[model samples]
Target: MEIRHFRYFLAVAKHRNFSRAAAQLGIAPPTLTRQIQDMESDLGTRLFLRLQREVSLTDAGRALQAEAELTVRQFEAAQLNAQRAGRGETGHIELGYVASAVFSGVLQKQVSSFRLRYPDIGFTISENLMPVLPGLIEEGRLDVGYIRSPMHLPEALSTISLLVEGFALALPGSSWLCRLKEINAAHLQNEIFILPEQISGTLQVAAQGGYAPTLGPQPGGLVAVVALVSLGQGVAVVPESMVDHIKLPNVVYRRIQDCQPSSFLSLVYRRFEKAPAVARFIEHVKDFSERPTL
Candidate 1:
Protein backbone atom coordinates (compact mmCIF):
# COMPACT_ATOMS: atom_id res chain seq x y z
CA MET A 1 0.00 0.00 0.00
CA GLU A 2 2.90 2.35 0.69
CA ILE A 3 6.63 2.48 0.05
CA ARG A 4 7.34 1.65 3.68
CA HIS A 5 5.40 -1.57 3.28
CA PHE A 6 7.61 -2.67 0.38
CA ARG A 7 10.70 -1.79 2.37
CA TYR A 8 9.45 -3.88 5.23
CA PHE A 9 8.35 -6.66 2.91
CA LEU A 10 11.77 -6.71 1.24
CA ALA A 11 13.53 -6.85 4.59
CA VAL A 12 11.30 -9.68 5.74
CA ALA A 13 11.65 -11.52 2.45
CA LYS A 14 15.43 -11.21 2.55
CA HIS A 15 15.87 -12.53 6.11
CA ARG A 16 13.10 -15.21 5.99
CA ASN A 17 13.22 -14.79 9.75
CA PHE A 18 11.01 -12.24 11.50
CA SER A 19 13.37 -11.69 14.43
CA ARG A 20 16.36 -11.26 12.15
CA ALA A 21 14.52 -8.81 9.88
CA ALA A 22 13.45 -6.79 12.92
CA ALA A 23 17.04 -6.71 14.14
CA GLN A 24 18.30 -5.60 10.72
CA LEU A 25 15.61 -2.89 10.48
CA GLY A 26 16.28 -1.72 14.05
CA ILE A 27 12.63 -2.05 14.91
CA ALA A 28 11.13 -4.16 17.70
CA PRO A 29 10.23 -7.64 16.51
CA PRO A 30 6.59 -7.12 17.51
CA THR A 31 6.38 -3.89 15.49
CA LEU A 32 7.87 -5.64 12.51
CA THR A 33 5.42 -8.51 12.91
CA ARG A 34 2.47 -6.12 13.05
CA GLN A 35 3.64 -4.24 9.95
CA ILE A 36 3.97 -7.49 8.02
CA GLN A 37 0.57 -8.59 9.20
CA ASP A 38 -0.96 -5.25 8.14
CA MET A 39 0.68 -5.52 4.73
CA GLU A 40 -0.63 -9.05 4.23
CA SER A 41 -4.13 -8.00 5.33
CA ASP A 42 -4.13 -5.09 2.92
CA LEU A 43 -2.96 -7.27 0.06
CA GLY A 44 -5.53 -9.98 0.86
CA THR A 45 -2.81 -12.63 1.04
CA ARG A 46 -0.39 -14.25 3.38
CA LEU A 47 3.22 -13.23 2.51
CA PHE A 48 5.08 -15.88 4.50
CA LEU A 49 4.69 -19.27 6.18
CA ARG A 50 5.09 -18.44 9.86
CA LEU A 51 6.88 -21.02 11.97
CA GLN A 52 8.16 -20.51 15.53
CA ARG A 53 11.75 -20.46 14.29
CA GLU A 54 11.44 -20.40 10.48
CA VAL A 55 9.72 -18.33 7.73
CA SER A 56 9.31 -18.89 3.99
CA LEU A 57 7.65 -16.90 1.24
CA THR A 58 4.23 -17.93 -0.10
CA ASP A 59 3.46 -17.68 -3.85
CA ALA A 60 1.82 -14.25 -3.35
CA GLY A 61 4.76 -13.03 -1.23
CA ARG A 62 7.25 -13.57 -4.09
CA ALA A 63 4.94 -11.82 -6.55
CA LEU A 64 4.58 -8.85 -4.22
CA GLN A 65 8.32 -8.73 -3.56
CA ALA A 66 9.16 -8.24 -7.25
CA GLU A 67 6.61 -5.47 -7.69
CA ALA A 68 7.44 -3.92 -4.30
CA GLU A 69 11.14 -3.79 -5.10
CA LEU A 70 10.40 -1.88 -8.26
CA THR A 71 8.14 0.57 -6.43
CA VAL A 72 10.78 1.26 -3.82
CA ARG A 73 13.41 1.75 -6.46
CA GLN A 74 11.15 4.16 -8.32
CA PHE A 75 10.48 6.25 -5.20
CA GLU A 76 14.16 6.48 -4.46
CA ALA A 77 14.93 7.46 -8.05
CA ALA A 78 12.25 10.14 -8.06
CA GLN A 79 13.52 11.53 -4.76
CA LEU A 80 17.09 11.73 -6.00
CA ASN A 81 15.99 13.32 -9.26
CA ALA A 82 14.12 16.07 -7.41
CA GLN A 83 17.10 16.72 -5.16
CA ARG A 84 19.42 16.93 -8.15
CA ALA A 85 17.37 19.72 -9.66
CA GLY A 86 17.21 21.58 -6.35
CA ARG A 87 20.97 21.44 -5.89
CA GLY A 88 21.64 22.40 -9.50
CA GLU A 89 23.08 18.99 -10.07
CA THR A 90 20.64 18.07 -12.87
CA GLY A 91 18.11 19.95 -15.02
CA HIS A 92 18.41 22.69 -17.63
CA ILE A 93 18.11 26.44 -18.01
CA GLU A 94 16.78 28.03 -21.19
CA LEU A 95 18.54 31.25 -22.15
CA GLY A 96 18.19 33.76 -24.95
CA TYR A 97 20.62 36.35 -26.31
CA VAL A 98 21.06 39.03 -28.91
CA ALA A 99 24.31 39.18 -30.95
CA SER A 100 25.95 42.24 -29.34
CA ALA A 101 25.82 40.34 -26.03
CA VAL A 102 29.03 38.45 -26.77
CA PHE A 103 30.93 41.73 -26.32
CA SER A 104 29.18 42.58 -23.05
CA GLY A 105 31.00 39.72 -21.26
CA VAL A 106 28.65 39.92 -18.30
CA LEU A 107 26.25 37.21 -19.38
CA GLN A 108 28.90 35.11 -21.09
CA LYS A 109 31.16 35.09 -18.05
CA GLN A 110 28.30 34.40 -15.70
CA VAL A 111 27.26 31.43 -17.80
CA SER A 112 30.76 29.98 -17.85
CA SER A 113 31.05 30.26 -14.09
CA PHE A 114 27.61 28.84 -13.50
CA ARG A 115 28.47 25.84 -15.66
CA LEU A 116 31.52 25.10 -13.56
CA ARG A 117 29.61 25.54 -10.35
CA TYR A 118 26.65 23.39 -11.43
CA PRO A 119 27.81 21.22 -14.26
CA ASP A 120 24.76 18.96 -14.11
CA ILE A 121 22.36 21.76 -14.88
CA GLY A 122 22.35 21.56 -18.67
CA PHE A 123 22.08 24.70 -20.78
CA THR A 124 19.79 25.42 -23.74
CA ILE A 125 20.81 28.59 -25.51
CA SER A 126 18.66 30.46 -28.06
CA GLU A 127 19.42 33.50 -30.14
CA ASN A 128 16.34 35.66 -29.72
CA LEU A 129 16.67 39.38 -30.20
CA MET A 130 14.70 42.18 -28.56
CA PRO A 131 12.00 42.85 -31.13
CA VAL A 132 10.43 39.38 -30.81
CA LEU A 133 10.89 38.74 -27.07
CA PRO A 134 7.73 40.34 -25.71
CA GLY A 135 5.81 37.15 -26.53
CA LEU A 136 8.64 34.80 -25.60
CA ILE A 137 9.28 36.08 -22.09
CA GLU A 138 5.60 36.60 -21.34
CA GLU A 139 4.65 33.15 -22.52
CA GLY A 140 7.32 31.64 -20.26
CA ARG A 141 9.14 30.22 -23.26
CA LEU A 142 12.36 32.03 -22.42
CA ASP A 143 13.75 31.64 -18.91
CA VAL A 144 16.36 34.40 -19.05
CA GLY A 145 18.05 36.65 -21.60
CA TYR A 146 20.75 39.20 -22.39
CA ILE A 147 19.01 42.01 -24.24
CA ARG A 148 19.30 45.67 -25.23
CA SER A 149 18.59 48.06 -22.41
CA PRO A 150 16.51 51.28 -22.01
CA MET A 151 13.51 49.63 -23.59
CA HIS A 152 10.16 49.03 -21.91
CA LEU A 153 10.84 45.74 -20.14
CA PRO A 154 7.92 43.37 -19.90
CA GLU A 155 5.71 43.68 -16.86
CA ALA A 156 6.52 41.17 -14.10
CA LEU A 157 10.09 40.77 -15.35
CA SER A 158 13.34 41.93 -13.74
CA THR A 159 16.45 43.46 -15.30
CA ILE A 160 19.97 44.17 -14.05
CA SER A 161 22.49 46.41 -15.83
CA LEU A 162 25.56 44.39 -16.64
CA LEU A 163 27.78 46.04 -19.26
CA VAL A 164 28.06 49.17 -21.40
CA GLU A 165 29.08 48.44 -25.00
CA GLY A 166 29.96 51.42 -27.09
CA PHE A 167 30.53 51.87 -30.78
CA ALA A 168 34.01 51.39 -32.26
CA LEU A 169 34.86 51.72 -35.92
CA ALA A 170 36.21 48.72 -37.83
CA LEU A 171 37.96 49.68 -41.04
CA PRO A 172 40.47 48.31 -43.49
CA GLY A 173 43.99 48.46 -42.09
CA SER A 174 44.80 50.92 -44.88
CA SER A 175 41.79 53.10 -44.06
CA TRP A 176 42.64 56.57 -42.66
CA LEU A 177 40.71 56.00 -39.41
CA CYS A 178 43.33 53.46 -38.33
CA ARG A 179 45.93 56.22 -38.45
CA LEU A 180 44.37 57.81 -35.35
CA LYS A 181 44.73 56.40 -31.88
CA GLU A 182 40.96 56.77 -31.71
CA ILE A 183 38.09 57.73 -34.03
CA ASN A 184 34.51 58.95 -33.65
CA ALA A 185 31.44 60.38 -35.46
CA ALA A 186 33.50 63.33 -36.67
CA HIS A 187 36.12 60.98 -38.11
CA LEU A 188 33.41 59.25 -40.08
CA GLN A 189 31.87 62.56 -41.16
CA ASN A 190 32.79 61.97 -44.77
CA GLU A 191 33.17 58.14 -44.60
CA ILE A 192 30.54 55.58 -45.44
CA PHE A 193 29.39 53.18 -42.67
CA ILE A 194 28.21 49.66 -43.39
CA LEU A 195 24.93 49.14 -41.50
CA PRO A 196 23.07 45.92 -40.73
CA GLU A 197 19.37 45.57 -41.17
CA GLN A 198 19.80 44.31 -37.63
CA ILE A 199 22.57 46.79 -36.83
CA SER A 200 21.84 46.43 -33.12
CA GLY A 201 25.37 47.12 -31.89
CA THR A 202 25.89 50.55 -33.45
CA LEU A 203 22.30 51.69 -33.92
CA GLN A 204 21.60 51.83 -30.19
CA VAL A 205 24.72 53.95 -29.61
CA ALA A 206 24.12 56.11 -32.67
CA ALA A 207 20.52 56.82 -31.71
CA GLN A 208 21.57 58.08 -28.31
CA GLY A 209 24.24 60.24 -29.95
CA GLY A 210 21.88 61.90 -32.49
CA TYR A 211 20.34 60.65 -35.73
CA ALA A 212 20.49 57.23 -37.30
CA PRO A 213 23.81 56.73 -39.09
CA THR A 214 23.76 57.00 -42.87
CA LEU A 215 24.26 53.56 -44.44
CA GLY A 216 26.61 52.50 -47.22
CA PRO A 217 25.76 48.79 -47.22
CA GLN A 218 23.07 46.81 -45.42
CA PRO A 219 23.93 43.52 -43.80
CA GLY A 220 22.22 41.22 -41.27
CA GLY A 221 23.56 40.03 -37.94
CA LEU A 222 27.14 40.42 -36.70
CA VAL A 223 28.72 38.04 -39.21
CA ALA A 224 27.27 39.97 -42.12
CA VAL A 225 28.39 43.22 -40.53
CA VAL A 226 31.93 41.89 -40.21
CA ALA A 227 31.92 40.49 -43.77
CA LEU A 228 30.92 43.85 -45.14
CA VAL A 229 33.68 45.62 -43.20
CA SER A 230 36.24 43.03 -44.34
CA LEU A 231 35.24 43.55 -47.98
CA GLY A 232 35.96 47.26 -47.69
CA GLN A 233 32.34 47.99 -48.50
CA GLY A 234 32.30 50.48 -45.60
CA VAL A 235 33.57 50.87 -42.07
CA ALA A 236 31.30 49.46 -39.38
CA VAL A 237 30.63 50.68 -35.82
CA VAL A 238 30.46 47.51 -33.79
CA PRO A 239 30.91 46.15 -30.30
CA GLU A 240 34.48 45.45 -29.30
CA SER A 241 34.03 41.69 -29.09
CA MET A 242 32.74 41.40 -32.64
CA VAL A 243 36.34 41.91 -33.63
CA ASP A 244 37.36 38.99 -31.45
CA HIS A 245 35.30 36.65 -33.64
CA ILE A 246 35.79 38.40 -36.96
CA LYS A 247 39.49 39.16 -37.15
CA LEU A 248 39.68 40.55 -40.62
CA PRO A 249 42.74 40.18 -42.84
CA ASN A 250 43.03 43.94 -43.27
CA VAL A 251 40.73 45.48 -40.69
CA VAL A 252 41.60 47.56 -37.66
CA TYR A 253 39.55 48.44 -34.58
CA ARG A 254 39.79 51.93 -33.16
CA ARG A 255 38.10 53.36 -30.09
CA ILE A 256 35.63 56.13 -30.73
CA GLN A 257 37.57 59.31 -30.07
CA ASP A 258 34.65 61.64 -29.47
CA CYS A 259 32.40 59.07 -27.76
CA GLN A 260 29.09 60.71 -28.27
CA PRO A 261 27.33 57.82 -26.38
CA SER A 262 27.32 54.13 -25.52
CA SER A 263 24.82 51.28 -25.30
CA PHE A 264 23.79 49.46 -22.10
CA LEU A 265 23.08 45.75 -21.83
CA SER A 266 21.61 43.83 -18.93
CA LEU A 267 20.64 40.34 -17.83
CA VAL A 268 16.89 39.95 -17.77
CA TYR A 269 14.95 37.37 -15.76
CA ARG A 270 11.31 36.62 -15.14
CA ARG A 271 10.06 38.17 -11.91
CA PHE A 272 8.58 36.08 -9.10
CA GLU A 273 8.77 32.86 -11.10
CA LYS A 274 10.45 30.50 -8.70
CA ALA A 275 11.67 27.06 -9.68
CA PRO A 276 14.26 25.24 -7.59
CA ALA A 277 16.54 24.62 -10.55
CA VAL A 278 16.23 28.13 -11.95
CA ALA A 279 16.92 29.68 -8.55
CA ARG A 280 20.08 27.66 -8.06
CA PHE A 281 21.33 28.47 -11.55
CA ILE A 282 20.76 32.20 -10.96
CA GLU A 283 22.50 32.05 -7.62
CA HIS A 284 25.56 30.62 -9.30
CA VAL A 285 25.33 33.41 -11.88
CA LYS A 286 24.86 36.09 -9.20
CA ASP A 287 27.80 34.79 -7.23
CA PHE A 288 29.90 34.95 -10.39
CA SER A 289 28.69 38.49 -11.04
CA GLU A 290 29.86 39.60 -7.61
CA ARG A 291 33.36 38.28 -8.19
CA PRO A 292 33.75 38.07 -12.01
CA THR A 293 36.68 35.63 -11.97
CA LEU A 294 35.43 34.35 -15.31
Candidate 2:
Protein backbone atom coordinates (compact mmCIF):
# COMPACT_ATOMS: atom_id res chain seq x y z
CA MET A 1 0.00 0.00 0.00
CA GLU A 2 2.88 2.37 0.93
CA ILE A 3 6.69 2.30 1.15
CA ARG A 4 6.54 2.00 4.93
CA HIS A 5 4.17 -0.99 4.61
CA PHE A 6 6.61 -2.76 2.29
CA ARG A 7 9.48 -2.06 4.67
CA TYR A 8 7.53 -3.37 7.64
CA PHE A 9 6.51 -6.48 5.75
CA LEU A 10 10.14 -7.13 4.72
CA ALA A 11 11.38 -6.66 8.28
CA VAL A 12 8.85 -9.17 9.59
CA ALA A 13 9.71 -11.56 6.77
CA LYS A 14 13.45 -11.29 7.52
CA HIS A 15 13.26 -12.01 11.23
CA ARG A 16 10.25 -14.44 10.97
CA ASN A 17 8.87 -13.02 14.22
CA PHE A 18 6.79 -9.87 14.70
CA SER A 19 8.29 -9.09 18.15
CA ARG A 20 11.88 -9.34 16.92
CA ALA A 21 11.13 -7.48 13.68
CA ALA A 22 9.42 -4.64 15.59
CA ALA A 23 12.45 -4.38 17.88
CA GLN A 24 14.73 -4.19 14.82
CA LEU A 25 12.51 -1.50 13.25
CA GLY A 26 12.33 0.48 16.54
CA ILE A 27 8.52 0.30 16.54
CA ALA A 28 5.95 -1.37 18.76
CA PRO A 29 5.15 -4.94 17.79
CA PRO A 30 1.42 -4.11 17.61
CA THR A 31 2.15 -1.16 15.33
CA LEU A 32 4.25 -3.34 13.05
CA THR A 33 1.54 -6.03 13.02
CA ARG A 34 -1.14 -3.47 12.17
CA GLN A 35 0.91 -2.02 9.33
CA ILE A 36 1.49 -5.44 7.80
CA GLN A 37 -2.18 -6.29 8.24
CA ASP A 38 -3.08 -3.09 6.44
CA MET A 39 -0.74 -3.98 3.51
CA GLU A 40 -2.29 -7.48 3.23
CA SER A 41 -5.77 -5.97 3.27
CA ASP A 42 -4.90 -3.49 0.52
CA LEU A 43 -3.53 -6.28 -1.66
CA GLY A 44 -6.47 -8.55 -0.80
CA THR A 45 -4.14 -11.44 -0.03
CA ARG A 46 -2.65 -13.09 3.08
CA LEU A 47 1.13 -12.44 2.93
CA PHE A 48 2.23 -14.52 5.93
CA LEU A 49 1.13 -17.67 7.75
CA ARG A 50 1.26 -16.90 11.47
CA LEU A 51 2.02 -19.78 13.76
CA GLN A 52 2.24 -19.79 17.61
CA ARG A 53 5.58 -17.90 17.71
CA GLU A 54 6.85 -17.93 14.07
CA VAL A 55 5.83 -16.72 10.60
CA SER A 56 6.27 -18.03 7.03
CA LEU A 57 5.75 -16.40 3.68
CA THR A 58 2.94 -17.29 1.28
CA ASP A 59 3.37 -17.61 -2.53
CA ALA A 60 2.11 -14.02 -3.05
CA GLY A 61 4.40 -12.78 -0.31
CA ARG A 62 7.49 -14.26 -2.02
CA ALA A 63 6.62 -12.48 -5.29
CA LEU A 64 5.99 -9.18 -3.51
CA GLN A 65 9.29 -9.53 -1.61
CA ALA A 66 11.35 -9.65 -4.79
CA GLU A 67 9.58 -6.66 -6.37
CA ALA A 68 9.72 -4.68 -3.11
CA GLU A 69 13.51 -5.08 -2.76
CA LEU A 70 14.10 -3.89 -6.31
CA THR A 71 11.70 -0.97 -5.94
CA VAL A 72 13.32 0.24 -2.71
CA ARG A 73 16.80 0.03 -4.20
CA GLN A 74 15.71 1.93 -7.30
CA PHE A 75 14.04 4.60 -5.20
CA GLU A 76 17.18 5.05 -3.10
CA ALA A 77 19.32 5.33 -6.23
CA ALA A 78 17.00 8.00 -7.68
CA GLN A 79 17.29 10.04 -4.49
CA LEU A 80 21.10 9.85 -4.64
CA ASN A 81 21.12 10.99 -8.29
CA ALA A 82 18.90 13.94 -7.46
CA GLN A 83 21.23 14.97 -4.66
CA ARG A 84 24.24 14.77 -6.98
CA ALA A 85 22.48 16.99 -9.52
CA GLY A 86 21.65 19.52 -6.82
CA ARG A 87 25.35 19.72 -5.87
CA GLY A 88 26.40 20.28 -9.53
CA GLU A 89 28.45 17.07 -9.46
CA THR A 90 26.31 15.37 -12.12
CA GLY A 91 24.51 17.08 -15.04
CA HIS A 92 24.84 18.22 -18.65
CA ILE A 93 26.17 21.50 -20.08
CA GLU A 94 26.42 22.75 -23.62
CA LEU A 95 29.45 25.00 -24.17
CA GLY A 96 30.05 27.09 -27.27
CA TYR A 97 33.30 28.79 -28.25
CA VAL A 98 35.12 30.69 -30.94
CA ALA A 99 37.92 28.83 -32.71
CA SER A 100 40.54 31.23 -31.28
CA ALA A 101 39.86 30.01 -27.77
CA VAL A 102 41.51 26.71 -28.68
CA PHE A 103 44.53 28.59 -30.00
CA SER A 104 45.37 29.88 -26.52
CA GLY A 105 45.26 26.33 -24.98
CA VAL A 106 43.81 27.78 -21.77
CA LEU A 107 40.32 26.65 -22.74
CA GLN A 108 41.41 23.08 -23.23
CA LYS A 109 43.44 23.09 -20.02
CA GLN A 110 40.56 24.41 -17.95
CA VAL A 111 38.09 21.92 -19.40
CA SER A 112 40.39 18.96 -18.86
CA SER A 113 41.06 20.03 -15.27
CA PHE A 114 37.36 20.49 -14.62
CA ARG A 115 36.63 17.03 -15.99
CA LEU A 116 39.18 15.51 -13.63
CA ARG A 117 37.59 17.30 -10.70
CA TYR A 118 33.95 16.56 -11.59
CA PRO A 119 33.85 13.37 -13.59
CA ASP A 120 30.11 12.92 -13.35
CA ILE A 121 29.40 16.32 -14.86
CA GLY A 122 28.92 15.90 -18.62
CA PHE A 123 29.19 18.58 -21.31
CA THR A 124 29.56 19.09 -25.06
CA ILE A 125 31.36 21.98 -26.80
CA SER A 126 30.84 23.53 -30.22
CA GLU A 127 32.97 25.97 -32.24
CA ASN A 128 30.85 28.88 -33.45
CA LEU A 129 31.49 32.22 -35.08
CA MET A 130 31.38 35.14 -32.62
CA PRO A 131 28.17 36.57 -34.09
CA VAL A 132 26.17 33.38 -33.58
CA LEU A 133 27.50 32.51 -30.12
CA PRO A 134 25.61 35.15 -28.16
CA GLY A 135 22.39 34.21 -29.93
CA LEU A 136 22.92 30.58 -29.02
CA ILE A 137 23.35 31.46 -25.36
CA GLU A 138 20.35 33.75 -25.38
CA GLU A 139 18.08 31.18 -27.03
CA GLY A 140 19.06 28.55 -24.46
CA ARG A 141 20.57 26.33 -27.13
CA LEU A 142 23.97 26.84 -25.49
CA ASP A 143 24.63 27.09 -21.77
CA VAL A 144 27.77 29.22 -22.14
CA GLY A 145 30.25 30.43 -24.73
CA TYR A 146 33.72 31.94 -25.18
CA ILE A 147 33.97 34.87 -27.59
CA ARG A 148 36.12 37.85 -28.50
CA SER A 149 35.62 40.93 -26.36
CA PRO A 150 33.43 44.03 -27.14
CA MET A 151 30.48 42.06 -28.49
CA HIS A 152 26.99 43.57 -28.67
CA LEU A 153 25.66 41.16 -26.05
CA PRO A 154 21.94 40.71 -25.43
CA GLU A 155 20.38 42.26 -22.36
CA ALA A 156 19.73 38.83 -20.84
CA LEU A 157 23.37 37.71 -21.08
CA SER A 158 26.49 38.59 -19.06
CA THR A 159 30.19 38.12 -19.76
CA ILE A 160 33.56 37.92 -17.99
CA SER A 161 36.92 38.43 -19.68
CA LEU A 162 39.04 35.32 -19.52
CA LEU A 163 42.41 36.69 -20.60
CA VAL A 164 43.93 39.77 -22.19
CA GLU A 165 46.44 39.32 -25.03
CA GLY A 166 48.08 41.31 -27.81
CA PHE A 167 47.71 41.12 -31.57
CA ALA A 168 50.17 39.51 -34.01
CA LEU A 169 50.44 40.15 -37.70
CA ALA A 170 49.88 37.09 -39.91
CA LEU A 171 51.69 37.45 -43.23
CA PRO A 172 52.76 35.25 -46.11
CA GLY A 173 56.13 33.64 -45.43
CA SER A 174 57.42 34.87 -48.81
CA SER A 175 56.26 38.44 -48.13
CA TRP A 176 58.93 41.14 -47.60
CA LEU A 177 57.32 42.29 -44.30
CA CYS A 178 58.35 39.01 -42.64
CA ARG A 179 61.92 40.32 -42.75
CA LEU A 180 61.07 42.98 -40.16
CA LYS A 181 61.82 42.36 -36.44
CA GLU A 182 58.52 43.91 -35.31
CA ILE A 183 55.77 45.38 -37.45
CA ASN A 184 54.51 48.91 -36.81
CA ALA A 185 51.05 50.15 -37.80
CA ALA A 186 52.67 52.49 -40.30
CA HIS A 187 54.07 49.50 -42.18
CA LEU A 188 50.57 48.08 -42.90
CA GLN A 189 49.19 51.12 -44.76
CA ASN A 190 49.58 49.62 -48.22
CA GLU A 191 48.78 45.96 -47.38
CA ILE A 192 45.49 44.26 -48.18
CA PHE A 193 43.69 43.06 -45.00
CA ILE A 194 42.33 39.48 -44.96
CA LEU A 195 39.99 39.70 -41.99
CA PRO A 196 37.94 37.16 -40.04
CA GLU A 197 34.25 38.06 -39.88
CA GLN A 198 34.40 38.79 -36.13
CA ILE A 199 37.83 40.47 -35.91
CA SER A 200 37.00 43.94 -34.60
CA GLY A 201 40.38 44.36 -32.86
CA THR A 202 42.26 43.58 -36.07
CA LEU A 203 40.08 46.04 -37.98
CA GLN A 204 40.75 48.74 -35.39
CA VAL A 205 44.52 48.24 -35.51
CA ALA A 206 44.48 48.33 -39.30
CA ALA A 207 42.41 51.54 -39.23
CA GLN A 208 44.89 53.21 -36.85
CA GLY A 209 47.54 52.71 -39.51
CA GLY A 210 45.77 55.34 -41.74
CA TYR A 211 44.72 52.70 -44.23
CA ALA A 212 41.13 52.32 -45.40
CA PRO A 213 42.17 48.81 -46.35
CA THR A 214 40.23 46.68 -48.83
CA LEU A 215 38.11 44.15 -46.85
CA GLY A 216 38.00 40.59 -48.10
CA PRO A 217 34.98 38.28 -47.77
CA GLN A 218 34.47 37.21 -44.12
CA PRO A 219 36.71 34.20 -43.57
CA GLY A 220 35.35 32.14 -40.64
CA GLY A 221 38.31 32.16 -38.20
CA LEU A 222 42.04 32.79 -37.97
CA VAL A 223 42.77 29.35 -39.36
CA ALA A 224 40.76 29.99 -42.47
CA VAL A 225 41.85 33.62 -42.63
CA VAL A 226 45.50 32.53 -42.35
CA ALA A 227 44.96 29.95 -45.07
CA LEU A 228 43.77 32.73 -47.34
CA VAL A 229 46.79 34.85 -46.36
CA SER A 230 49.15 31.94 -47.13
CA LEU A 231 47.80 32.09 -50.69
CA GLY A 232 49.03 35.71 -50.83
CA GLN A 233 45.41 36.88 -50.67
CA GLY A 234 46.04 39.56 -47.99
CA VAL A 235 47.61 40.10 -44.58
CA ALA A 236 45.72 39.34 -41.32
CA VAL A 237 46.10 40.62 -37.79
CA VAL A 238 45.10 38.02 -35.21
CA PRO A 239 45.57 37.14 -31.53
CA GLU A 240 49.18 36.31 -30.72
CA SER A 241 48.18 32.82 -29.60
CA MET A 242 46.93 31.96 -33.10
CA VAL A 243 50.54 31.11 -33.89
CA ASP A 244 50.35 28.14 -31.54
CA HIS A 245 47.54 26.33 -33.36
CA ILE A 246 47.56 27.67 -36.90
CA LYS A 247 51.22 27.19 -37.69
CA LEU A 248 51.61 26.93 -41.46
CA PRO A 249 54.85 26.63 -43.40
CA ASN A 250 53.81 29.46 -45.71
CA VAL A 251 52.51 31.72 -42.91
CA VAL A 252 54.57 33.72 -40.40
CA TYR A 253 53.46 35.64 -37.28
CA ARG A 254 54.99 39.00 -36.38
CA ARG A 255 54.40 40.96 -33.18
CA ILE A 256 52.72 44.32 -33.68
CA GLN A 257 55.02 47.15 -32.60
CA ASP A 258 54.34 50.83 -31.74
CA CYS A 259 50.58 50.19 -31.75
CA GLN A 260 49.68 47.22 -29.53
CA PRO A 261 46.06 46.31 -30.03
CA SER A 262 44.18 44.78 -27.09
CA SER A 263 42.95 41.21 -27.64
CA PHE A 264 41.04 39.22 -25.06
CA LEU A 265 38.56 36.31 -24.69
CA SER A 266 35.33 36.51 -22.72
CA LEU A 267 32.89 33.92 -21.37
CA VAL A 268 29.24 34.60 -22.15
CA TYR A 269 26.21 33.02 -20.54
CA ARG A 270 22.65 33.73 -19.52
CA ARG A 271 22.46 35.96 -16.48
CA PHE A 272 20.01 33.57 -14.81
CA GLU A 273 21.13 30.16 -16.01
CA LYS A 274 19.15 27.51 -14.17
CA ALA A 275 21.56 24.62 -14.48
CA PRO A 276 23.72 23.96 -11.44
CA ALA A 277 26.35 22.42 -13.71
CA VAL A 278 26.66 25.69 -15.66
CA ALA A 279 27.18 27.61 -12.44
CA ARG A 280 29.91 25.20 -11.39
CA PHE A 281 31.63 25.58 -14.76
CA ILE A 282 31.42 29.40 -14.55
CA GLU A 283 32.96 29.32 -11.07
CA HIS A 284 35.71 27.00 -12.24
CA VAL A 285 36.50 29.36 -15.11
CA LYS A 286 36.63 32.32 -12.74
CA ASP A 287 39.24 30.50 -10.67
CA PHE A 288 41.17 29.61 -13.80
CA SER A 289 41.12 33.22 -15.02
CA GLU A 290 42.71 34.43 -11.78
CA ARG A 291 45.75 32.18 -12.24
CA PRO A 292 49.05 34.03 -12.80
CA THR A 293 50.23 32.20 -15.93
CA LEU A 294 46.91 31.74 -17.73
Which candidate should be chosen as best, given TM-score against the real structure? 2
TM-score of 2: 0.92
What is the Cα-based TM-score of model 1? 0.79
Global Cα RMSD, each model: 3.6, 1.9
- CA error at residue 125 for candidate 1, angstroms: 1.4
Candidate 1 residues 129-238, lDDT tens each? 56666458667897787776756776888876767656667888778777776565655655677874345655644654566666786655667777777777778877
Cα displacement (Å) at residue 242, model 2: 1.6
Q: Give a tens-digit lDDT track for model 2, residues 163-192.
A: 787877888998889888777888887788
Candidate 2 residue pairs in clash (backbone atoms < 3 Å): none
User: In model 1, what are the clashing residue pairs, if there are any?
Assistant: 183-257
Error of 2 at 294 (Å): 9.1
Instruction: Give the lowest summed-lDDT range of ten residues in model 1.
Output: 196-205
In model 1, how large is the Cα lDDT of residue 40? 86
